[model samples]
Target chain A: MKLWTLTEGNKEFINETGSITKFANRFFIVGMKPRYEFKELLTQCYLIGYKSLPLVALTGFIMGLVLTMQLRPSLIVYGVESQLPEMVGISIVREVGPVITALIFAGKIGSSIGAELGSMKVTEQIDAMEVSGINPFKFLVATRIISTTLMLPILTVLADAIALFGSYIGVNINSVTSFSLFFTQVFQGLDLNDLLPAVIKTFFFGFAVGVVGCYKGFNSNKGTKGVGIAANSAVVLSSVLIFIIDLLAVQIADLMGLNY
Target chain B: MGNYAENNMRLGIFVLVGLIVLIFAFYMVGKNKSIFGGNFELKARFSNSNGLMKGSNVLYSGIQAGTVKSLKLINDTTIEATLLIDNEVKSFIRKNAIVTIGTEGLMGNKVIQITPFKGNSPLVKEGDLLESKKVASIDEMLQTLSRTNDNIAGISDGLRQTVVEINKSTLWKLLGDKAAANGIESTINQMHQASINANAFSKDLEMILSETKSGKGTAGLLLTDTAFATQLRMALVGIKSAGDHANELTLQLNQMASDLKKDLDNSNGFLNFLVKDSLMIKKLNATMDNIEKGTDGFNQNMEALKHNFLFRGYFKKLEKEKEKRKTIDQSLRIDK
Candidate 1:
């Protein structure tokens, strides 16, 4: 029985991977179609990006604060506590700001996408849309994926800015740094390479999170319990994909000689 | 439709703000790179770029004044770097500035440092080639450091061996011994005594030096008394004149002695005969004896003449005349 169950799990894993790839490919096809869901895409962008700002800002601010406070003693040990802002800036602009914001985005946006579509699937709304010749894939999946793809980079940028601002506040918590000086120090260490790669990777991160969430939701079981499972799995898978994408992004950046 | 439009407006605003933030980031990075500002191109050449790349920072006196635009290896040993420098720093960089490649931090990116010279020179113009300085690359520095580390290790090993040898020697044992301690103590005591003597000698020397400083002694007078110095100089001049006179006199005496010696050397010379001829001396003695006898005979003849009566009358008349003249002369000369 254990052998059978392991075999079944492997098959299920392969099937899930194939299904997601198919869904992503179908999204690409439907998303590039003529009737672009401009209004819905805008609504999703508002929902995904603007509405998520407060939480992202709070998280970003806290991230900067906690990281700076935690790093101070260690940096002070090396007598480079003065470079705290530059260090924090490089970290946020390079790695922390995008990755942390994406993780938070996956938790919030990914779960919502999954639960919304999952309930729609359970209620036969998607099927109803398909019968009405609405091309549900274009209306629902493509729009959300495009919105995530477009919106995440913008969100990541805002989040990075907030995080740096938070980092400034953090730097001033124990030691006094003027707002101008803190920002100067931060921008001083940042390069186009650092900013570009981090921003670029968020696009991929958003696409992955959106696809996973939409895939989980649109393909959820016809039962009530499936909605919960879909939402939970969507967040989990999107979170995992965020790390994977981040890894790929770093590798690609390194290959392009942008890692410096 | 109204709600949808409002949502779209919110989304538009959000997207605009994000783009603005991103553009601002780009602007800041570009500004740091000296990209957007008014700038001019300058050239620097280096023997080795030391991993310097395009877009590396150019620091002017430790401030970010520019960035490297391109680096091309012009020859086997020279890398020509084109720099985009801000126009604001144009007045500061001199024509004779030295450019060097250095690291940003311990393990950071390579940076170009433009070190300006202090003296008068023209401000650096665009396209003018600034002098490049060859800096030790990290590899070379590490190589030197490795060699130094090896030397230190060898030295430390030698020191360890020396310590071992010292441990093996009897010195430590001697130091621990009571008898040796006593001998060492005596030696230290002798050294202390010698040091005290040396210190006392130093003090005496210092005292002599102080006396010299006060200008009181002969040395001091010679050094400080201007009037005495002038008198001494006059005396020296007089002595020199006297010496010159004595030298002339000595030279004259030497000439006379040389002439006298020549005369004496010739046996027939009158001055030689007068000086040292024995035969001339004998003849002169005989002549002198004959003169004396003749003078005695004349005296006898005069006495005889006076005794004769005829001579006596003449002599008496002459005597009377001489007496009369003497009386007349005496009377004339009496009180005059």
Candidate 2:
């Protein structure tokens, strides 16, 4: 029975792998088609990037503040509390800021894209667009994927700034540090390698989030209840993909000897 | 369309802000790398790089001034590190500057430190080789610490062995022996007795001093009695006077001896003649012998006269007359 269960699990894994490949093919095909509506892309950018900023900014600030507060006692134990800004800055820029902000973006933008597309699929709006000879995938999936791919890095930069500012405030709450000094210390240990690789990885994070969300939503089934499932699965899958991309980015950066 | 315009404006603002932050981040990181500044290169040769990497911060007096450009091996034993320093701080880094590798914190990144030379030495020219010092790395320090720990272990083992051998020694056994212990005890007791005797002696001396202070002993009387002192003075004066009289008697005896010598020198004196004349001495001796013989014959004649009959009657009458006279005198005294 255990062997049967294992075999079934293997089959399911193979089926999921096939579905993923099909989704990737469709995503690439849709990406390659030159019917990119700048208007639609702008609209999706507005929805996915600009609309999500406030929440991302808020989460980024709280994440930085809480991270600083949590890391303080450990650094104080090592008597390196003076290194808080630099340490936190490197962590946020190199790893935390991009990953956390992307995760948040995944949760907010991914679920929104999934739900909206899933609803359109459920209501047969996508079907109508297809019958009317409109390229729904171009209007819907490609714009979002492009917008996310472009916007996430920008958002990550902004989030990293806000989070560093939050960390400065957090530092000032315990110790007395001026903004200029905090920024100076934050920049002192930082190099282009630390910033560039992390920023580059966020583009991938954004792509993963967008592709997973659109894939789940575009292929959503079961009608009304499938919208919630699509939204949930999109967030879950995108969040997981964000970490995988980060891990791959780190490994690549290590191979390139950029992780000094 | 209005909504799209608003969204576009918002997107523009968002992208613009993001670009500004990204630029600022790049600027800050570039500034740390001395990328945005006019820079000069300097080189240093070291025996060991000590984990100093390319792009590690170059510090001047603990302030970030530049970054390490590259590290290349010059030979089997030496590594040459190139530093890109900001041109603004070029004057401060002189030709005599010393470059050494150091760590950021206890466990932080390695850094290259440039110690500027004092005085108006010439500025370090581009590509000039500054002096390099190899810092001790953590591994080296740990190896030294490990050697020290092994030495400490060796010393402690020796000490432990010494202690164990001492514990097993004859001296230690002797200390534990009853007879030796008794001897030590007796010696200690003798010392205790001596200490007690000394204490008693000091007490007795203290008592004597106290008695002397209170004028209770002979020494105290000698010290305190003023009348006795006066009598002593008087006795000393009398002795002095007697000594003077004895001196006068001695002078008188000397004068008598001189006068006797003068009398003896006047040869007419009988003692002088007897001392000077040998014939007179012989006559004096003959006269003394004749006197002695004559006295014996006289005493014999007197005895014969007392025994002769004629003489005896006369002698008897004379004796009777003498006796009668004595009786008559006695009767006269008794009658009166």
Candidate 3:
């Protein structure tokens, strides 16, 4: 199939989209039928999810704190200053917590995954693996994808908790609300549907970031410069895909009546 | 191998913490009645639930005691809401408890308020159907408000028409006249003076009223002094009695005057008979002389009889009685 576009950029975009789609299909075909890379998957999970925790936590905490402080005056003007906890809680859990954490993860881990794999290809380590009867894609790409998919939700959960704790401190900067009371207000009238959909969506976020990063890395060219380009493009594309996937998720959640 | 195990352990802990936090969040967000405790079911039927959904708090006498279990439409107008109450506080909710849908905050969720009956009411059993009442929802209030808004619009329209009429009327011309304006100004000045005087008068009146309330003067005595009132009552009674006597005396005088007038009108006046008729005059003179002689003879005989022996004791006793009467009269005069 050919995409007829006047610009080479458009043509390249379509070409990349097709290749990524095929690559994602191949991943499903190959990764699931693996001589299960459990050890590699664990190490990747440790590197991707655990190592990403500090940055995600920092981003989430700042987002929550700043959001509360900004919303404080407006909420006070509306005479609902007490609703700071609840509004911040919902924004973090439902939208901000997962999405922002994913963006940060894409920046840190996407680039890292891309550069690492690209460098391996450039050095012919992947070729060496293939010649030595070892499946490089199975060991590297599959493990990374599975790790990111499994670990991102965990990371998002931790970030959400941290952000809420930050918001608690933010709330205390102006008024005194007990920890229990703050939590009670946050949880009051909240539904499982809200939490489940948000958590479930992060899986797709994780998958998009992983696949884009791996796809960029696998298709890299021109040696060392290729790795840098791969890393940069991986971050950009995966970040875009996070927002896109978020839009699709909102629509799907609305369709399923899981949006509260 | 040791480094690998340590890293794995750290990763395991992090993942465990994340999973724990996620579960905690879900639990906090969705926990209702019977989640961590035994719960008893209670039901209430309302005409309109008015957005009171399931999992709404069932606040028993303003305490969190339960949660709304489910809502079912029995008919077009009736909604049956089942409640799941914690077993710990189940005994407090009486069978006669009243259920009403209330709002949490001004712009917050709807809640079910259960008011406990403060009498010798029995404890609510499992699946008891409690009483319920429908409260006005925000939508209904807004609907009423819109109707009121229409009424206000109509009132303003009428006012505007009245104002326009006034603007076009001859009264507006009259108001612009110099003489009328001067007259109005004079009247207003006089009214201001009158109001000032009235204010002073009112102050005096208020002071007088306060004084009267404190029993200060005759009017105050009449109002507040019971003894003074009793004395006035007695005085009025005496005056009434005196007036009655005076009336009787005046009536007697009137009767006597009328009798004398009748006698004079009959031409039988003694002075007229004596002065106008000569024969009557001669007879009256002879009769008078005879009466004088008889009176003198009688006096002489009484004097002789008083000196006789049998009459002497009686005369002496009469004299003694006179003396005693005189002494008694003297004593009465002294007492007076």
Per TM-score, the best of the predicted structures is: 2
State, as a TM-score between 0 and 1, how close model 1 is to the true structure: 0.68
C-alpha lDDT (0 to 100) for residue B61 of candidate 1: 92
lDDT of 3 by residue, A1-260 (tens): 24444577787889999999998898899988949899999999999988898899899889889988999999999999988888998888999999999999999999999999999889999899999998988998999998889899999999999999999999999889999999888876456767888999999999998999998988888999999999999999999999999999999999987774
Displacement of residue A236 (Cα, Å) in model 3 is 1.0
State the lDDT of candidate 2 residue by residue for B1-336, as single tens digits.
Answer: 887898899999999999999998999899989889799899999998878889989999998889999999999998999899999888788888888888887888888999977766787788999988767788988999999999999999999999999899998899889999999999999999999999999999999888988887988777888887799899999999999999999999999888778878876566777788899999999999999999999999999988988788888888888988999899999999
Q: TM-score order of candidates, best first?
A: 2, 3, 1
What lDDT tens digits, residue by residue, belong to model 1 across residues B138-193? 79889999999999999999999999998889997886899989998999999999
For candidate 2, the per-residue lDDT at B26 reads 96
Q: What's each prediction's TM-score?
A: 0.68, 0.70, 0.70
* Off by more than 4 A, model 1: B103-109, B135-336
> Backbone clashes in each candidate structure, one number apiece?
0, 0, 0
Error of 2 at A163 (Å): 1.4
Residue pairs clashing, model 1 = none
Candidate 3 lDDT (Cα, whole model)? 0.89
For candidate 3, the per-residue lDDT at A105 reads: 93
- What lDDT tens digits, residue by residue, belong to model 1 across residues A1-260? 99999999999999999999999998877778888877778888899889998999899989988888999999999877888998999998899999999999999999999999999999999999999998888899988998898888998899889988888888888989999999998998888989899988999999999999999999999587999999999999999989988999899999999987
- Of the two candidates 2 and 3, the one with more favorable TM-score, higher being better, is 2
> What are the chain A TM-scores of the candidates, in order?
0.98, 0.95, 0.96
Chain B only, TM-score of each candidate: 0.48, 0.57, 0.50
Model 2 pairs in collision: none
